[model samples]
Target: MAQARQLEQEQGQGSFVQSVKSELFSPEKRQGNLNIALSLSVFAGAIVFLRNFGELLAV
Candidate 1:
């Protein structure tokens, strides 16, 4: 009935999510994560320097 249909749909969705999660978090994803971290660090460093440039100039 409706309950059985709902259970089947839930099982199907769960398997799809697991497959996607496995793919997304594979070894290749580690490299992507590293790249993102490096990019963010560089961006933050640039912003910090720009915001404190006056203090740096006074030194």
Candidate 2:
């Protein structure tokens, strides 16, 4: 059972890496991925800014 679990984990990791490589090489997906990363960073930055602003007001 342990051996089977290890094999399964290795296979899962390999597939994950393969999928990432495919996405990275595909031009169509590149833009979508960049947009997603940009949006997530902006959202996080906004949250941090808001938290600091609130703290400043409290002081």
TM-score of each: 0.47, 0.62
- Which residue runs does candidate 2 get wrong by more than 4 Å? 1-12, 55-59
- Model 1: per-residue lDDT, tens digit, 1-59? 99999999999999999988876688868788778889999999998888878476675
lDDT of each candidate versus the true structure:
0.88, 0.91
Candidate No. with top TM-score: 2
User: Ten consecutive residues with minimal summed lDDT in candidate 1?
Assistant: 50-59
Model 2, range 4-57, lDDT digits (tens) per residue? 999999999999999989988688898988999999999999999988796776
Model 2 lDDT-worst window of ten: 50-59
- Please provide the root mean square deviation of candidate 2 (C-alpha atoms, Å): 4.0
Q: Give me the displacement of residue 59 in model 1, in angstroms.
A: 17
Q: How many clashing residue pairs, candidate 2?
A: 0
